[model samples]
Target: MTDHEDDLGPRVASFRELRGMSLRALAAAAGVSTSFLSQLENGRTNASVASLRKIAGALGVSPAELLDERAAHTRGVLRADRRPRLEGALGVEKFVLSLPPLRNLEVYAGEFAPGASTGANPYTHGNAQEMFVVIEGTVVFELGGERFEMSRDDSIEFLSSVPHRIVNESEAEARVIWINSPPTPDEAHGA
Candidate 1:
């Protein structure tokens, strides 16, 4: 397993404890066996993508939240090398640019390799507003059933509840910024 996978156990334990959830409680909610969760928390086992998703959903957070750790030494600022990040679906690397004390906002900087995508299917979350801005290269933003091809400096906004996904169909890498107001499963779920 990679360092990120190794850290998942501790992050899960921390989040579960913070939420005042017991091992059995979380396992039941996530529909996984207690022994599995225990082993996962103890680093005796690794979690599959499906299991991770279930656990994250049960905890009212995105899988990425459970995988990332704040490594910056300075307060209110995220060092480039220390930024919390998510190795997103299909070669998409998402870095959370907003530091701790998250408040009601969240910002993500993403690098999408050629053919990279948010996921195979669109997804919706939170009840706030969301915006996607392309910094370089080209990307396709699929919102609901519509597809909008965006290039450098182009942007689009919509409710966070709308099913959406970003895709880089170009041969070059695409850099983009995503902004969410009132955050998402984090502050939105009172985390």
Candidate 2:
């Protein structure tokens, strides 16, 4: 793990603010306490691998990015498989498929087990937009008063500012590639 990964709170917090998520909101989304997140961000404590993965997921980064600022500063071609996975709750799984720092946008590929999701209630960001495709198994998407049953190769794109939910009903694992960009408040803005 890199220094940031070793001391993940501050970097993770920075990305939270970047995404316009409150400590309470992020803590809720990551399945951790706000106080714990505060401590981590303040550099008063070290995060577990699970915790780091959750924070990285919420921040739309790979677990490795928090540790390796070098990648954040490195400018060149990067391999998709080499990118890091963002951490989430104990049962949830998410990762940035491939993203370079300072780019104004972020993309991710996430896997949710049979009963996991982003969180209990939906979350919103500034002008945020997300698109996801079910690469395998089935994904249940609740967006804008619609319940979409997405199977393999099914996809949906919408304003993330709207409340949403995701679920995997298949006996097999559910895999989705999601892209989130420009934060929240930008939802009403032009594409």
Candidate 3:
């Protein structure tokens, strides 16, 4: 077996442990057989992304976490004005937004270029109240049935439980820092 197979096993085991879930119980939740889960945990089988996703969802985790400790850890934080950018879905770019990584919360800075939007789909996250502090320009915040406009230095805090989206209609880029305490909303669920 390749190293990838070995790396995947512990994550499976970790998930089971974190939820205090039995193998049979987790299998039932994931729609997989107990024997299959056992093999996957022991690195005897290759678990597909779909299986991993189901496992993650049932455990209230993001699929990206399946990478776990296998990825290298960065040595230090990226400085202000030097924050690395991660582009998310819907053509949005999320900058570090100038916040350090601490235990209880995660802070992100994002910039939406002119005409960029979070799209029209409405979705709910586990538990998060995203506080947006507009630092650069104006943004139209759409939360559930309400819409609000925020300007420079203006802020809006709301529960992330409902569907929301942001639109930057101006010709200039919209910069904002999003702060979330207890980073993972469904953190009460798993590893």
Q: Pick the candidate with the highest lDDT.
A: 1
Query: Best candidate per TM-score, number?
Result: 1
| Candidate 1 residue runs with Cα over 4 Å from true position | 1-77, 187-191
Cα lDDT tens digits for candidate 3, 1-191: 66656777777777566455688877898898899889988888887889888876665565666556542222234676687676554646786542322334557777788888766664555577668788898989887878888899998887767677788888899887877654644332110
RMSD of 2: 12.8
lDDT of 1 by residue, 44-102 (tens): 99999999999988876778888777621122345889888865786888898865344
Every model's TM-score: 0.58, 0.52, 0.51
**How much lDDT does candidate 1 score?**
0.82
- The reply for model 2, stretches above 4 Å from the true place, is 1-81, 183-191
Candidate 3 least-lDDT 10 residues: 182-191
What is candidate 2's TM-score against the reference?
Answer: 0.52
Candidate 2, 45-155: lDDT as tens digits: 788889888877766677887776554333345576677766665456777654533345666677778877666655555556677788888878888667899998988
- The C-alpha RMSD in Å for every predicted model, in order, reads 12.9, 12.8, 10.7
Q: After superposition, how far is residue 142 of candidate 3 from its true place, in Å?
A: 0.3
| Cα-lDDT of candidate 2 | 0.69
